[model samples]
Target: MARSLSKPARTSLLPWLGLAFVIILCDQLTKIAILRVFSYGESVSLTSFFNLVLVYNLGAAFSFLASAGGWQRWALTALGLGAALVIIYMLQRHGTQRLFCTALAFILGGALGNVIDRLAYGHVIDFLDFHLNAWHFPAFNLADSAITLGAILLIFDELRRVRHGSR
Candidate 1:
């Protein structure tokens, strides 16, 4: 019997894992650079609305539950690990879906990046800042940016899928 040629090859896991590693490297490297160059809470203006600053956030985005004493640390850490595991499961199941895969990769990279910080520093290092006269957004880092962008992409992808009736 002739061998069938229609079967596709299996997808490799290297690229996705590499993407996550790159995200973590960039996140940690930038944080280190900021920590070395600036004092905690010090800002060096790079533009009219942007600054390279150093901050250690002991809480989640916008400092949610920041004042809840020490328990927030373990709680957030567990949440991060749980989310990472879920993303990994989804990636394994649906990685061939490009949009979904990208979204998951970004989220995974970001979650691990911050998780590294929590384990090493007991806090997350945030440097990028945006502000206007009399108004300021909370400082954040590369991982946070990636995570937010990933979430937005996931939403957009879902919306597109819904519009196209592709599920």
Candidate 2:
């Protein structure tokens, strides 16, 4: 059976929600700066292995459905917004769980950041570029970074929970 929290032990979701807000703010701010400073496809070399390039993704990660025309744009926006709602719900329920809430907050922030871009520009702005030799990875933004980090943390949290045999 799972242990229950007493009234005094219950935690609020406000803190985690604030963290999500911060993430979203940072993500959007950077995107705004990139949009204002860089033109489409413009790249500024930051290092031998990396460049700052402005790009827009109309589809999901890796531009999964980028060529599918305009329908995918609304579809992706709806999906992201829906995911954010669900994540908020999850966070409200598990606010006392630090790792879980952190992961959800990251996802919620990233999803909101991308959704905002999709709504405002019909695409997500990406600028970070990494390349080595002949290989070049796709450009991504801080929102994507937070989401990736959150996923890794989620996996680690699950592993830890499993090892502890806690339900």
- Compared with the true structure, all predictions reach lDDT values of 0.86, 0.90
lDDT per residue for candidate 2 within 9-86, as digits (tens), equals 346878988998999999999999998999999999988999999999988898899999899999999999899889
Q: Which ten residues in a row have the lowest lDDT in candidate 2?
A: 4-13
Error of 2 at 154 (Å): 0.6
- Ten-residue region with minimum lDDT total, candidate 1: 7-16
- The candidate scoring highest on TM-score is 2
Q: What's the distance in Å from true for residue 16, model 2? A: 1.0
Model 2 scores a C-alpha lDDT of 0.90
Give the best candidate by lDDT.
2
How good is model 2 by TM-score? 0.93
Off by over 4 Å in 2: 1-10
Put down candidate 1 lDDT per residue, 1-167, tens digits, no spaces.
99997743336656676887789899999988888889987888888998888989999999888788878888889999999899887777676777877877888899999999888988889999999975789999999988998899899999999999985
